[model samples]
Target: MSALTGAAAVAGCGGDDAGGTSSNSPGATSGGAERDCSLKHPVCTAVTSDCVAVHDNQGATTLGLRMAQLTITKPDVLASGYVAGLVTQGLTMNLPQCNLNGTGTFSWLLEFDTTTGKLRTGGAMPTVDPREGYCFANMTAGEFEIAPTEIDAPLTDGAWSGEAETLNVPIFLETSPEPIILPLHQVRLTDAKVSADNNCIGRYNVEGLEWDNACLPGQDGDPPAFINGGKLAAFITLEEVDRVIVDAVKQSLCVVLSGDIVKYGTGADTNTCKRDENDQIVLKGDWCSATNSPATDDCADAYALGGEYAASAVKINGLCPQ
Candidate 1:
């Protein structure tokens, strides 16, 4: 969640000239006493989802700021096609309707803190206070702010189309009136199965893909590491069709989706683990203490979570492939 710095503190639990922590502030917890993880709120155990949900929905709002949404689409995307991951690098912001001005870019880099992919803005815009109906009330003609999120990735690409919307606007009291809403929406390349030729090509490299504990727990040496004690599985396919073979290509590995490792082994001596694609090793999925012993089981479900892999590497096993 973004923070309101300097002097943009008013409606909700915003602070003043003195920088105050949200928890320490008077009204920070005023929103219905901060709902707990009850049957009403329900806990989401998925790791990958936690960050996206927070930043995607309430991020700008938490900081008392708003975000712009970007969408991309392709004109002639075939019915049987898919892009595992697409990155958006450059972006610009403009709000002609609001009679306001500012700048910034949004991208996929924020999805994973460690990724190098990113989008940047050229300048700043005044913060959008939904409380004030996204009003640009505080700033003079020149002052501005920047708001961004990790969910703005281009979901589709292939003769594509795109749009950007700024959530930075104003809001008014119920008695005051209505405000402008910047709804970001897009439909990128749709999902479609590969053709027979493509499917045949996708099948040639099945042996190259395998699950291992590279991204699992106890491997990074740092407990706080993102993949520490985590589980992962990948399915990789290499195919040759139409005289074109997508080599060194990677798609998705299912186990990594849940953001948690699928368990394997007996009641107590069970060994939980995940396969890390980048490092090509099995990582411990179960968390261990300095004193506790490691899991007794040597193998985790290799095909767990429908995990798939599509990568290009020189080594096919402990030794490189000829």
Candidate 2:
């Protein structure tokens, strides 16, 4: 947290022309309402979520984000069959749990908060129904949990950054016997900003999303105390990939099509498939062997994951059933 001075109010939040304190200053609250994140989210019990509390004197704004997509670009985690492709698609699927369609209540939320002095972010569950609108599930958190539960970063000039060792990413795959948990490591989030436009954009990391200056929200160039868009980079070692996912990958990759882990040839030969003496198209290390996969393009050890994501804004209309 650096010193804030000289018209340092966030973009959307109004600041005093005098550069002191105003009704719209960063220290201002929502109409002097109690700053209790628990009030916004009733479903997020202490046992599951990290509740956020608004101090009596602090000014803060909270944004409830639903996971729009988590697309994995690196490693080419494609499948050998249609079933496998469907499984891989789950990582980027637009599930209806967001309550925007038929109204199946679900929750996978993150709280992006810009307080008077710090930038805080945390995740919690929200049981929202389409009829009920946004649940704003209790986003209260104490001391931003480590090991990747919740994190706090320095908001420098409206840009903040932080790193975590690993995080448990719960991704529901359609072709799995059970839910799939993606354990990510060496996680790094960079280029976080909240302005009319900046080099960084979007709330997620993945491929195929095109967000630029023209696509950003806001008008004035002034940045806020909290950041919005940035790049999320992480790594997943071969060992880190779950056996079930490996099995899923095996179903779609040629390397394991024959029920054996057939790696590519020695040397710089990184081919997706090669014909053997019998002319059978055999799968090699080409699946996760992308240049950015891991081990510096040597896919024998890991896979590189990258992406850009977009988030839908929702107003906290009501609380969820306790």
Candidate number of the best TM-score: 2
Instruction: State the lDDT of candidate 1 residue by residue for 161-238, as single tens digits.
Output: 122332222211122122211111221211211111111001111122111211111111121111111111211111
What tens digits encode model 2's per-residue C-alpha lDDT throughout 1-322?
Answer: 0111111111111233222223332222568453221112222111121111111111225544443323334444321233223322332212221101111222333445555323233222332232233443332222212122456654556566667666655433334433334456666666655322221235321121112211111122112111234566776544334222323333212332223334431111221233469753433332242343434333444445554333333333334333
All candidates: TM-score:
0.14, 0.43
lDDT of each: 0.18, 0.33
* Native RMSD of candidate 1 (Å): 24.5
Q: Supply candidate 2's per-residue lDDT for 262.
A: 40
Q: What TM-score quantifies how close candidate 2 is to the native fold? A: 0.43
Q: Candidate 1: global Cα-lDDT? A: 0.18
